[model samples]
Target: MSTCKNCQNQLTPDSDYCNKCGARVIRNRLTFGNLFTHFSEEFLNYDNKLLQTFIALFAKPEAVIRSYISGTRKKYVNVISYFAIAITIAGIQLFILQRFFPEAMSMDSISTEATKEFNLKILEFIQDYQSIAMMLNVPIYALVSKLVFIGEKKFKYNYTEHLVIYMYLLAQLSAIGTVIIVTAAAFDLSLGTTSLILSPIQFIYIGYALKRIFNLDWTNFIMRTLIFICALIAFTVIASIVTGVLMYFNGDFQKMIEAQKAANEAARTVKDTIN
Candidate 1:
């Protein structure tokens, strides 16, 4: 223990500065070198620990979640941080894939001018409405999951636990979709059809993960899976319809661009005839 010279406040031996008056407290025999050393010792170490924790998290998600809920949270990253990092990585992959993959962006090499216009409009609408769509999806998924899990009290997981599991599944699904989009884009493969097939597979993976994570029986798992799948299909259909309507209205923007292109071509043709 030590005392602050200015305020005469008692301080712990481990404290570098006085809490009461902000006076610098001397460490080990009041030596300046000792103070610096003590301060460094107190605050400057743990890179390896954090790395190890992340490794465990990636390798053993169920164990990590169990540990977290069991009050050993400080040993691993918070769930929100994990989700954020996963989303960021997925987003980057999607962006890169879109930049490099021509086929993923378009269905055919020679899309009709109208179809091209429609696709561009759809892309623009996605950019504008993505956040709203995500927000809406969350509550809808929660409600659907809750309803699906009802009467399955044998699983021993609460509604909130199920919700967290759904969230984890959603994050994983998003990441996988990002990878698929990027890869399809790189190969010039149209993702429209690929997405359709991949959606069900993704749900299957989610169901498997949920079963393992929650120790659910096969019958209950399949029932919950079907319910979730139905919810997903409904959500997708609704979203597609909404986006299609928006794109229909937004088509005029693309038409103006096409018109400008045609006008320029006509002007060039006239200039060439005169020459």
Candidate 2:
């Protein structure tokens, strides 16, 4: 009898695959070439689930989301794993930018010194804890989506389902956004400009995905999309108010004012020298 290395299943000597586990019978020791071949088969093959999932997300999102939600998971990468991959990619992109294109991360050329300081502080926090920030956004997005789609009786997805929905949506966006941001950075684009370019596409793709998932008519889709945008705007306003209050209490506003005065003094000195 031969043994399957993967599952310890008994096998006939002539069998090429394990009957129980379906792993291919490997008769040779592990080597670099074989490892590369295995990786190509798993991730780069034509039938690989990751590639299928990525293409299907844009081609037929409803089928992918519905199948996973209905417990048919083998055909596509699950939400958690896909999201983790996206977050990892995003982290790598941040590292590349900070390492090779540090100036792209700054906003000083486009803003006053005080504004630049505030923006840099925000940027630093985001860069330092981006994964946490992304994880936090998922739940908030799920809540907003659930509230918006509460009236759908036929496809009544619960809060957790909404979480799954946004997880997939955000992961896809992150993947695409990572590529765009990296390419833009290579060409010396500012992070702010790249974000401005991406934000609309992100919103449009989210609306497109939701429309397909719900099979909504154009009118209903537009209405719901606008409502979603308004809800997000309200949330942003509230968060900004709270953040401003916190900044004031922490004396950040005083620092900003001082920075602004120093910047003004420097600008006036330069002007006098020019005169």
Candidate 3:
């Protein structure tokens, strides 16, 4: 009797596969040549899949999401793995900026005391918790998506499906955002001004992606896109306020405000003496 190497199942000499485990009956031994060849093949295959995913994500995000939902698995990385890796890359970028590009962003130059305090508190909160903040966005995106994009058949994406879509979308966006941050730091660009300049690009990318995903015509597309944008703005404002309030009660925000106010008063006293 011949045996299957994979499961050690008894088989006829003529059998091409193991009956018990459905394993392919391979004849080749584990040679160094085969090991190298297999390693290269797997590595290249993974690299290719990653590239295809990013291309589809940037060039036609809706199509990639749709394809994944339709059971196509080979062309892209799984959403969970993609999101984890993307967030880690983003965290690296944030660390680099915070450590090496300290002067890239500062509210210290602003004159208004309240504005300075509020902005500094917010900035510190964001800097400290940006990774967690972005991760928190996944569920919010899924929620908003299900709310805004409800329809039948081709237009309908269920909540879990929408979660998958958002995971991929957010991963790609996080990578893009990290790149934008690095570029701004390199050029000594104002993050506020850069955000303003990039807002339309963000809207356009999202609008086109959603339009394709929803299969909407121009009028409905514009209406739905605007509504989604408004929803996002509202959600962001609420989240920011909640974060600020929590930090305030914890005494973190109070410390920032007091420090800023003391600095401002000292500056005022110095100016008065000079006058």
- For each candidate in the order shown, give its overall lDDT on alpha carbons: 0.63, 0.90, 0.78
Best of the candidates, lDDT = 2
lDDT of 3 by residue, 155-214 (tens): 687898989888887788778777887798789865554566567776677677777777
After superposing candidate 1 on the true structure, give the runs of residues whose Cα lies further than 4 Å from its correct spot: 1-61, 69-71, 107-122, 127-136, 155-160, 238-275
lDDT tens digits by residue: candidate 2, 1-275: 88998999999989999989999999989999999999999999979999999999999999889999999999999999999999999999999999998878866545665578778777888998999988988998888888889898778999999999999999999999999988998999989888888999999899999999999999989988998998888887887788888989999878888888888999999999999
- Model 3: colliding residue pairs: none
Q: In candidate 2, where is summed lDDT lowest over 10 consecutive residues? A: 106-115
Please give the distance, in angstroms, between residue 36's alpha carbon in candidate 2 and its true position after superposition: 1.3
Best by TM-score: 2
> At residue 221, what lDDT does model 1 achieve?
76
Q: Show model 3 residue runs off by greater than 4 Å.
A: 1-47, 105-112, 151-153, 190-193
By descending TM-score, how would the candidates be arranged? 2, 3, 1
RMSD of each: 8.7, 2.3, 5.0
Pairs of residues clashing in candidate 1: 101-185, 103-188
Error of 3 at 204 (Å): 2.4
lDDT of 1 by residue, 20-132 (tens): 98977754485788778766664454544334444553455566656655667766666665556556765576466556664465533434544655555555554456445
